[model samples]
Target: MRKLILFDLDGTLVDIFDEHINSFIRMEKEVFGVDIAPEDMIKNIGHPARVVIAGPLLERGIDPKVIEKRMETAYQSYKKQLGKALKRIGEDVVLPGVFRLLEVLSQRGEILGLITGNISTVGMLILERTGLVKYFKVHSFGDVAAKRSQMIERAVELAEEKYGFTIKKEDVFIVGDSIPDIRGGKEFGCKTIAVATGLTKGSDLEKEKPDFLFSSLENTEEVLKAFGDQI
Candidate 1:
C-alpha cells in the first residue's frame, strides 16, 4: 500500500490553537469593531475562519450581506494578525515526536500532506518557518474548503495530481486532536488517529473512537505502528 498521511497542523503537529483564537479576535476587533465570543471559536477550530464566523453569526441572525462584505477584510486582518502572532510564538509549538515521525515517514516513501483550517498562505508560512514544509507533498487549507471533509477531498485531488498516483481512502490516515477532525476523516472513510496533544482531552478523544487513539505522539514506535510501518 502506498500510504498517504494527512496531518492537521494546529492541534496535532503544532501548539498555536490559543494564538489562532487570539488572532481571530484581534482581526475581528480591528476590522469589524465587534469582538466575537471565544466560545464560538473554541468549538470550531477545525473549520475555515470565515466559515467559523459566518456559522455563528448567521445562527445569531447577523445579515448575510454583512458577512459577505466583511469576509475579505476579515481574512486580510486575520493574515496580518497571524503573522505577528507566529513571530512572537515561535516554532516551539511543534509537538513531541513530530519531527522524528515526519522524518521517518518521509524516509519510508509515504506521501505526506497537510489539511488544516488555516488558509494556504498562512499554513505554508507556518510550515516554512517551523521547518516542516519539506515533508509535505501537497496541502488543502481553509481557503480551499469551508468544511473539513471538503478540504480533505480537495487535498486528495491535489495529492493524486501532484504524485500521479491514486491513494486508497483506507490507506490515507487522518491525524488530529479534535472530534471534528475525526468526524471529517470518517466522512471520507479514512482511518483517523486522535492525538491528545491539543485542546481536547485524551478521554474525550477516546469517546470519539478514532481508529487509533494515543495520549500523545511522544511514542514514536507506537505511532509508526498504528499507520503500518511497512518499512
Candidate 2:
C-alpha cells in the first residue's frame, strides 16, 4: 500500500512566515485601506490566515459579523495581490533538506499531498514559486476549514479520489512545524511528524508527543528512517 504523505506549507516546507505576514499587511492596506501593526499578527504565524488576521481585528472591537464579511473580501484580495507581493519581496522560501526529502519521496513513489493553513491560491503560488507544486497530487487548504484536522480530512478525501486508492489513517503522515499540525494529525488519527524549524520550540513540540520529531528537515536520511518500513 502506498502511504499518503501530507505536508504543511509556510514554516514547514518554506520559511515564509515573514513574507506571509507582510503580504497580509499589504493586502489590508492596499485593498481595505487599513493598516495593521506588525506585532498584531506576527506571533500567530502558524494559524490559519483567517484566524491570524481576525485576532487584531477582534482586539480592535470590530464586530464579529463585520469581520467575517470583511475576511471573505480580504481572502480574495490577498489571493489577487499575493503573487505581486511575493515577487517583489519574497526571498528563498525553501528550507533545508526540503528538496532532497521531496525528491526521495517522489522517487520512492509515495503519494504526496499538501495540507496548509494558507488558502489554495496563496499555497499554490508559494509552491509553484519554489518548484515544489509538481510533487503534490493532492491538496487541502485553509479556506476549506478553520482547523487543521478538517483540512487533513479534506486532503484524505481528495487523495483517495485523485489517486484511486483508499488509505489507512495510520499510513497517512501529517508533517508540519506547529502545535496545531501535530494536534490536528493526532485528532484525525493520522501519524504526526513534528519538525521544529518554525515558531514553535523543540520542547513544546516534544510535549505534543508526535510519532516522530525532528529539529529540522535538514537531516533527510533520518527523517526518512522515521517514516518506518513504508519508506
Candidate 3:
C-alpha cells in the first residue's frame, strides 16, 4: 500500500543538532541578552521553534508573557541566523541513507510530506539545499502550527487537497526521532516510526513504543520494510 509518510526534518532527515543549538543560543543571548543552554534546547527538540525556544527562557525565569511578546521578533532573528548557519554547514547535514530511502520511496509511488518543527522558509531551505525538496508534495511547518499534532493535521489536509484523495489516518505514518513525534502520531491516530538518529536516546524512544523503531535509516532495505515496501 502507498502510505502518506510524514517526516520530521531536523533530526530524522538531517543532523542539525549543532547548528540548531548554536543558532538558538545566539538568538537568545545576542537578541534577548539571555543565555540559553544547549541541553535545554535538546530537551525541547522536535517541538515548534517557539516552544523549543520558550522552554529554556521559561526555565531561566523569564516571564512567559515576556517571552510571548518577544517571540515574533526573536523567531525572525532566529530564522535569519539559522539560514546563515545552514549555508555554512552546507549539505553535509543530510543524514546517512536519507537520499536513497527518499529516492526509493518516491520511486515506489508513495506520498511523502514534511511535518517539521521548522518554519516554512527555514525548512524549505534545508530541503532545497539537500535536493530533497522535490520528493515532498506537502509541507507542514512549525511557525504555521503551534504543535506537532497541528502540523500533522495540516499535512493531511494539504495532501488531500493537493492530490484530491482522502487519506485514512491509519495509512499515515509519522516518522521522527523524538518522543513528541511518536506521542503526537499516536494521539493523532497514525502509525509512528521512531528513528534514533536524533538527540533522543533509543531507550527513550522505545518507551514510546512506536509502530517501528530503528537505530538509523542507514539500512535502506530494512527501513523500507518498515514502510511496508515489499523489497
lDDT of 3 by residue, 137-181 (tens): 999998998888888999999999988889999889999999999
TM-score attained by model 3: 0.96
Which portions of model 2 miss their true places by more than 4 Å? 30-34, 88-91, 229-231
Better of 1 and 3 by lDDT: 3
Local distance difference test scores for all models:
0.84, 0.84, 0.88
lDDT of 2 by residue, 1-231 (tens): 888999998778888666777778887776456689888877666777788777777777777887787887889877876777677533367888898899899999889999888888888888888889889999998888888898999999988888788889978999999999999999999999999988899899999999999999988878998777434
**In terms of TM-score, which candidate is strongest?**
3
Residues 114-169, candidate 1: write the lDDT tens digits.
98888778899899878888899889888768677887888889888988888888
Candidate 3 off by > 4 Å: none
Model number with the top lDDT:
3
The 10-residue segment of model 3 with minimum total lDDT is: 85-94
> How does residue 200 of candidate 1 score in lDDT?
85
lDDT score of residue 155 within candidate 1: 81
In order of appearance, the predictions have TM-scores of 0.94, 0.92, 0.96
